[model samples]
Target chain A: SQTIHQWPATLVQPVGSPLSLECTVEGTSNPNLYWYRQAAGRGLQLLFYSVGIGQISSEVPQNLSASRPQDRQFILSSKKLLLSDSGFYLCAWGGTSGIYEQYFGPGTRLTVT
Target chain B: AQSVTQLDSHVSVSEGTPVLLRCNYSSSYSPSLFWYVQHPNKGLQLLLKYTSAATLVKGINGFEAEFKKSETSFHLTKPSAHMSDAAEYFCVVSDRGGGGADGLTFGKGTHLIIQP
Candidate 1:
């Protein structure tokens, strides 16, 4: 069985501070990773996705960026956080064959004050 | 371009009643559809997916959705609504071009409220 883990379950930061959220998947190799943001009561907004190491595609342009430093390690980072960046950040992973389902991590709730 | 629309923003149903949440999609290619449930303060969970397999896709927790290509709709339904079923449901469309782990477009979401 595969398991996804995320750190700093919740965080409170002042605006203009740096932000770093980590996601990792165990028991799977070369999996597809994604980062998404969900507002209070809205759908998910895709931020970035990684197909392989050092390869990332960003969907919406913003202050945040994502990196696949390792096969199973995906990090979402920002040099400076904005008030608008306050939301629930989620990480997901999927297989490479046929797409049917995606497994998600617990998620990081970041509040930029 | 592919997009999804969830017809309802909020649906209230009494426990033990039937549940129906409507969803319609627009896709260029043979699209894949999915239903996800998000509980408060919890990550999104995959309820079910439709990929040209069975038109009726059964998911966890006794949830199921029907894919109607003629209507371009994938409506989720449950014969009986449970109190635990109260949550936010999202209709999602995936980009087949994104491979298995590509991109998914989500609807605004329908909040399922259960009346005791």
Candidate 2:
């Protein structure tokens, strides 16, 4: 069975602070990875997706960036966080065979004050 | 371009009553559709998906959705609503082209409220 892990589960940060969120998947290799953000009572917004190591496609231009350092490891980073960056971040993985069904990680809730 | 529209923003139903959440979609080609549920403070969980093979797709937790191509709609339904079923539901659509790299377009979501 495939599983995704994300941390730190929840975080509270002051404005203009650096941010880093990590996601790792087990039981699968070469899977596509994605990063999504959801505001309270809002739909999920795609931020970035990676097809392979060092390959990332960003959907929205914002204060966040994503990196695929390894085959199953994806990291979301921000040099400086904005108040608008407060939201729930999700990591997802899908098979390389063009499957649209994605498996999501536990997610991280970030609160910027 | 592909998009999804959830017809209802909020739906309230008494426990044990039938549940229905309507969704409409637009796509240039044959599209893949999905339903996902998100409980408060949790990640999204895929409920069901339609890939053109079967019009009626059954998912976890006794949830099912029918794909109507003529209507361009895929509506989720359940025989009985449970208290645990109260959550936010999102309707999603993905393009079949570009090797699935187009990602998914999500609807605003429908909040399902289970009344006791």
Candidate 3:
């Protein structure tokens, strides 16, 4: 069975600080990875997605970026965080084949103060 | 382009009562739809999905959803509501031909409340 892992489970960052959230999937290779943000009282918004290593697609323009360093490792990063950047960050993976359902990780809660 | 709309923001139902969360979607062509549940501060868990297959899809935890293409609707239902079912439900639409590189559009969500 395949499983996804993300950390740190929770994070507190100061304004203008750097941000880094990691996501890794085990038992799968060349899977599609995605990053989404769920703001308070709002639905989730897709931030970025990657089909393969070194290939990242941005769904929306924001203060963050994504990178797939390895076939199973994806990272979400920001040079400087903003108050609006605070939200629940989720990492998801799907098969490279046809349109399939995605599986989400436990998620990271980031609070920018 | 594709979009999803959840009819209710909050729904309250007594325990053991039937659960129905309405959802409507718009797509250029045949699209994939899904229902996901989110607990407080947790990630979304897929409840059911409709991907050009069975009209009625059964999911985990006694939850199911029916795909009504005529009405452009994919409504989620439950035979009996449980206290644990009191969480936010989301309707999602995906029209990408293939691969997860395409992002999914999510509904604002319906907050299901269970009355003891």
Model 3 residue A43 CA deviation in Å: 0.5
Choose the strongest candidate by lDDT: 2
Clashes of 2: 0
Give the poorly placed runs of model 3, Cα more than 4 Å off: B98-100
Return the top candidate by TM-score: 2
Please give, for residues A1-113, the per-residue lDDT of candidate 1 as tens digits. Answer: 88999988999999999999999999888999999999786788889999999999988999999999999999999999999999999999985676546788989999999
Candidate 3 local lDDT, residue B57: 93
In model 3, how many backbone clashes occur? 0
Model 2, B36-90: lDDT tens per residue?
9999888889999999898999999999999999999999999999999999999
lDDT of 3 at A34: 93
Look at candidate 2 and give me any clashing residue pairs: none
Q: Which lDDT tens digits does candidate 2 get at residues A60-112?
A: 99989999989999999999999999999999998567678888998999999
Better of 1 and 2 by lDDT: 2
DockQ scores for all predicted structures: 0.67, 0.72, 0.75
Q: Each candidate: fraction of true contacts kept? A: 0.59, 0.59, 0.68
lDDT of 1 by residue, B58-109 (tens): 9999999999999999999999999999999999988676543565778999
- DockQ for candidate 2, please give it: 0.72
TM-score of 3: 0.96
Instruction: Give the whole-model CA lDDT for all candidates, comma-separated.
Output: 0.90, 0.92, 0.91
lDDT, candidate 3, B1-116, per-residue tens: 78899999999999999999999999886788899999998888988888899999999999999989899999999999999999999998888763346647789999999999
